[model samples]
Target chain A: MIKFSKQQLKIPQMSKPVYLVTGGMSKFDRAIPEKRTEELVIDAFLEAAEFIKKSPEELKEYIHSCYYGHFADHFGDQLLGEAVIHDRLGLDPLGNVGIKTGGATGGSTIWEAYKAVASGYSDTALAMGWERMDEVPTDEGNHYIASAADKDWETPMGHIYTGYYAVMAQKYWQVFGKEEESFRRTLAEIAVKNKGYARMNPHAQSPMKITVEDVLNSPIVADPLRALDCCLMSVGASCVILADEKTAYELTDNPLLLYTSAGSHTLRVADRRDMDIPLLPNESPDQYKDLGVRFPGGDRYPGFTGFLAARMAAYYAYGMAGIVDPTEDLDLVELHDAFTISDIQSYEDIGIRPYGEGRTYVESGDCYHTNPFTGQPGKLPANLSGGLIGCMHAVGATGIMQVIEVAQHIWGRWSEMHADEAKWKRFNRVKPDDWTDLQVKGAKRGLAISHAGVGSHVTATVLVHPDHQLKGRG
Target chain B: MTTQNRGTVKVENGRYRVTGNFHYAYPNDPIRDESGKLLGITNPADMTHIHAYGGEAPFFENLSNAKLLGTKCANPKCETYGSIYIPYRIHCPDCLMRNEEVDLTELARKGASVHTFMITERTGAFNTLEKPIRFVNVEFEGVSTILMGYLSIGEPEIGMKVVPIFQTKNPTFTIMDLSWVPAGTSVEDLPEGFAF
Candidate 1:
């Protein structure tokens, strides 16, 4: 591991070293039924490339490198659709190298881009992720992913991604004392909020506002989780243009900054790790105790109130954002609402509210975009752009979108952030000085948190607003 | 399209076995062999193995070549009684592997009854037209791979002992190679309009 100058790592509470020039992207998947993966990647490229306003050759010259994020298992799907980048932008092939990680390939891809800029490796680099999942049949697609799973223990048990997570959800329900309805409520809220948000994003794969009642009432796909709770089958591509501060100022008037972002992952097995979706291994009470779930009664972890990955990702995020206290500090937040329960659980895990008290935040109306329930000068308003549930996650791109979501709101790009919420109003705003006693006061930071679920593996990240902006954390 | 309903091969008393769902096919198509050689083919003997389980392999170790195997549920005396399956289930599906080690044994390629069938005109990867096709769910004696496949015989009847014919190229004994035949062949009492 390379060591960074201690000064570089030392982020001042109010201001930070970094400033984002600009990041551009296309919809999650642009080639659903008609185009090739190339078209999908090109869609995002053309979009961000347009912002450069440079001739084809000129844009190519600016791209220090290209990192293609993909999850295709075979050669045909290996590299990112760089063929499009070469043909359209006329870039040399050397810059394009396929970066493959499991489901979070996109999140990791963004992480990579973040590092590239911070390290001065690339003044302007294109981080693009794309997939044409619908081209293949469902069973065929499933077979490809299932091939990635452990063939020895999992495949034999007919463990699809669903069953693996289902088992843990079952176990978590039993361990936590949270009610199934509570968890369901959380998930449904996420789905509904996302649906509402997607309606604002014209490019969203599936854009339609649904109600929590509708989500809970949808057909149960795997016990408590309904078909709607799952992410959609998507073929989307998203790109983010990263530029150093000097380059960004030269390009655009308003540059979105990437203050601070951190990511971490755990083991991918139920037996190898003892964590559940709603319960961190280090957290109090086992899944059985928390959910009060019994093997019988057709209920699994019956007590889980929300998601586990949400809490973990949010925890790391709160730490990174310098948010020692959440309820009264964070001005605005966006968590990957892959499921609605994730949002509610995020409220508790991120310390927005006390444990088992997320419901209170919701009930008191301080936790929602419109609530400001705490009314403590400033309350943390969350998921103004819906989230993954709102945006319809396309695996890798979905995670990247979470980062984009928070940044858009901080930069006040909400009009272009989500189409449905184009006229969407900002929910809650917290004054820095009034935030729960965690700082020297007068710290304006916009915090963005993201969580991803790959079977059961989850990653959380926290992003802090830079030192230049020290009014209140947005 | 098939489903988890594929219990075509059964395991009983810890030994696995199956019955053949056979069919017939005319070869010499434009297809080439592994060596890419184009040879005109026409011989029953040369094509008969195409109808056997796993072809040249003894007892058809890998019947995936096209053989249809039948056996009882891995768990005998299940709550639903003796349900049949194909693809050799390791245990009772209802019990989801909870009940293991039911006995499986092979039986004659003949059948004892046909539970039911559906008539349709589907003719492609999807069923969307008004043509004509018949799908039958048949049962054989003792062995349990409640066979689901295409039926050529007209108007199937329950309890009628039926025989299966098979296709020629790469047969390896799956139900596609098999068609239904009358329990007893008699020229003196031929049924009117009975097509071969």
Candidate 2:
């Protein structure tokens, strides 16, 4: 028998503690053609400044540096985007750097800001992401987005962004062996549930209520994936301020701590195989294939590898936070639902469900606001800000947008925002008597997951309310 | 003795062979028509090319000759020694050893099955098809890697047997030169590969 010793996993610790002071995002929509990226950033920055209780000038003076995330300034034919934003904001000539990590650009920028504050280099730092995709035609915009895939292999074969997910959806259907109609209905349910939440979020672009039937009836952008299943391309910007413990206390009474963060990436999805498939058969006698196999490793399966990266990221973050089970430990979640299939796959990838059982969790309504598992209200509400599906995806802005939404839930300020009354009444076709049911009440801990490319890059973060007591700390 | 008063020194066997040279060009200059209508460019260059070495070179050359090739791990201790890779890599991912090139024509001749497929109806920059184009992820028998190519037939079903149809005539020396058609389709009936 081969003896395998337990391996110790190292979790990143900050030299100087970092805290999330506040986060804000502009209303995500396709109608923002008149608004420039700088204007959107300024709007979100001002909104975030309001939470600090400091004058605009004072807040500006406190910020030590700025990190901007943007995807394809060529979409609007603009260059020197970071310089333009820096000039418009009138920040001191300390330093401002631009970041680009495809869809995870927002989260990557935030991570950079966190490092600045955590490293004791800055007392306060600003991370912002914006995209003005509406400036170009749909094809031109798609051309910009397709630049994320492998230019040599994937793009030449006519595999666009939607086609990548569509292939995964098809493979998912094959692996599960469920009825075609039933599988599609489950996907539609995911769309309906997300759009239902979008109706409550004021920042959502398409907050209009949708049905499973409506999703199924929508035109197929890529087979197995409808127009409704894909996220809307919109123009928006999101900003978050990170600071040290002292600065956080000065900013607000309810500061959210950046507990743990992890990110992983694969240049191409084809390079890695799916984790769901059993690489080595249980009955096989080949010990080499069985023992050497690692999750997110091996090329036995053809499914998307992004889910494996997500799992790896989540494990690192969860380990750092001493969280054994994310599904139960997390009070709420903000996941990257760029596509409906992505949401379903995330459930399994994030350890919420076992392999090939993502659809089962979705059908059980366990992830919804009203938890069927506990027969209680707000068990673990996901994508309360409509996610990328209903909230509209501004590419680079999505990661920070997810962080902002999770922060809002942790602060218990989600329900205070305006929601369409009529649409709220018709939500899920099972309207509750009170509007508070829509909110995840007393959410002390939340997780935000974001990804870019075709599951090429992924980031997972855990946030805890400042008031919440830690296990060892007072 | 000659070092003190040598006007010129002769070196023996000093000539070296030049392995390669790199050329760089930029298309910063704009071009205009005779009337200065502002056309595109005269000597436009992207300066980007696929850098191929070792097994990758043969991988493309085989495609030009209407054949498929894969890389096999040379290390006997490697777990996936016998298995083949479609996009041939120089080093084995698991064992970290250089791989040996292998011909995959026989495995492909046995035909492959559709692991998964997607049809895109919405046209984009690369997808300029009048109708939806079906792209299939094929799993060649005995091969470890999956090859992504367009399906020459109509709607593709899971587990459908597919045979590789190479564009031998005037091949573009790209992965686009190869596609998968249904197993029973006659050689004369195979559709043309999708235009890149």
Candidate 3:
């Protein structure tokens, strides 16, 4: 191990010369019209504009450039998507780009946007994606995802997507010994939570909240996982606003100032020879100590396939924020609970509880169905915004929605948060120690986790809450 | 001797022909494992053969003689799961889970039933199984979807009992050695035993 002095261990906090704030989306997927590519991006750009009460002239002046992410079957359109979208916004574009990152096109898009703001390329840039994938037939879609697989070795061996996830799920069951009942109950809780969120969201395909028994009886997708566990194929668009600290104040009366943003992407899974060195998310187990995860021995106690990726991401975010003792500090998280299992693992991986204590945390009424930290009644909070599960996902826009949830939570739009049958319970409050850790000690650093693939990633971003008392430059 | 490789991704330089060894499912529609991997099927079970020279992966030679069937864990880590994986891994690359040639109890082929299925209107193998052909995901109690073949019967439903029935490609594709049927059935309801 490379041991360093305590003074040398400190990581430099990056400074942004310009701010790119607010990420926006125009629905991840819908029965989008087969129109010219320009029309689709224009619609998504307008949809993003709707989130903020921005005027054409004022919006044009603050907006610097745009980055568009898309994955079309063929090189259908070669024009700059940013230019096309910006032209509709009628802005003097300083920077405009378009990229494709396979299934992760959306998350990669936001990461690119964050880089632009950090690089001082444009003061306030827009990163957006629009894909109407229903056009690709299911078989053709299968072919597309398989295109990324090792064509000769893996594909010929009949290693398809579900097979890979099934192998992991089965292995998780073998390791955790957390029987089907445990997986079932966790999934039910996630489904109910997301459906509740969808009630407030008109765009969600399944807006009605369902019961645990309802999911238990549903058709099984794979052996253990049922239909309810999968995300729907829905059509929608969304966007999140990212701006500089000063511009954040000007963007809205309440602005979620992004404190630190770091993300990593892996083109292939098997290339990494060693388990210790995870290529993506670029963080290690030691880093978790900084992210406020009170892991004993500074090592991740392994359990669950989906949680590992997220844990790595959280560890990096923790390093950026210098957060320790995460279980007590952070309050209110909006993670990519892509599947029911993903939600369960986040509970343990994010240091809410020790590893293997995830199942017990749920039973003790901690993670979902009730706010564990605050014990707010009628709150089945996690993915209240229907998440990707209830909201359905089109890949690229899911991360933007995750950013929106954190913003909405800090904004006190309780309805926007996932709380079912939850009447505003003003009676309960955070325990004194917990309260200090959250409101004062860790309030400046709120953590958010996002994942990709089936248990493939974890992106934890620590958003430092801006305080009026702080003398830092606005 | 050296060519700065431009497009040399493909490795199968040997032209190992598989002519007339085409595998068919759903009467003709080929069955592919999820992730859209085509599960290799031989039209007639007899036509199915493997030629691994100086290779590994323990083939259960006297598998028919002994009630137990087994395969070596080319992937040792995969050994814990009873080698249940179709196209079983030699050393389980998935979990890094290790295992050797562990003893495995063969599944009771008699009580096999359709777990879940889709009467495909159209899919990858639409030509093989027609728009209305049944492609049920079946599990023989103790096994996975490792078993895939023709179950010539009525409508494929949940828990519909099917014996180890096989078809032929010109030549009769039949499980001649192990002609099995439902555990308990009336004489009138007996299946016609066929061997290719």
DockQ of all predictions against the true structure, Cα-based: 0.02, 0.23, 0.04
Which wins on DockQ, candidate 2 or candidate 3? 2
Name the weakest run of 10 consecutive residues (lDDT summed) in model 2 chain A: A275-284
For model 2, residues A146-191, the per-residue Cα lDDT tens digits are: 6677755666665366776677776665555243688789888778
Please give fnat for model 2: 0.42
Q: Write the per-residue lDDT of candidate 1 for residues A1-474, one digit (tens) a residue.
A: 012245533332422233444445555432344445566666666655554465445555666877666666432343435555445555566466665555666666765666676678777776777555654455445545544554332332232344334433433333332346765576566576556555555455555557778887887654455667666656677777667777766666666555444433322332121223343323454433533233232222112233444454544444444455655445566665554444555566656664444556555655455444444532555655545555555655655655555566555555543433322222111122221211112323455554444323344434444544333222
Ranking by TM-score: 2, 3, 1
Q: Which is the better candidate, 1 or 3, if ranked by lDDT?
A: 1
Regions of candidate 1 where Cα sits further than 4 Å from its true position = A1-16, A28-31, A49-60, A74-89, A174-177, A180-183, A259-266, A272-321, A326-329, A342-350, A353-367, A372-378, A416-474, B1-196
Candidate 1 residue-wise lDDT at B11: 59
lDDT of 3 at A301: 24
List clashing residue pairs in candidate 2. none
lDDT of 3 by residue, A84-184 (tens): 65566565546667656544455556666666666766567676665555644465444444445443222322223433334334434434424557656
Q: How much is A40 displaced in model 1, in angstroms?
A: 2.4
Which prediction has more favorable lDDT, 2 or 3?
Answer: 2
Point out the worst 10-residue segment of candidate 1 chain A by lDDT.
Answer: A431-440
Give a tens-digit lDDT track for model 1, residues B1-196: 2122323456578665654433344343353467877532322211112222332222133232223444344445554345554434444545454333322222324444553343432122222112344444445555333444344555544345554433434542322334445555443333232212
TM-score of 3: 0.59
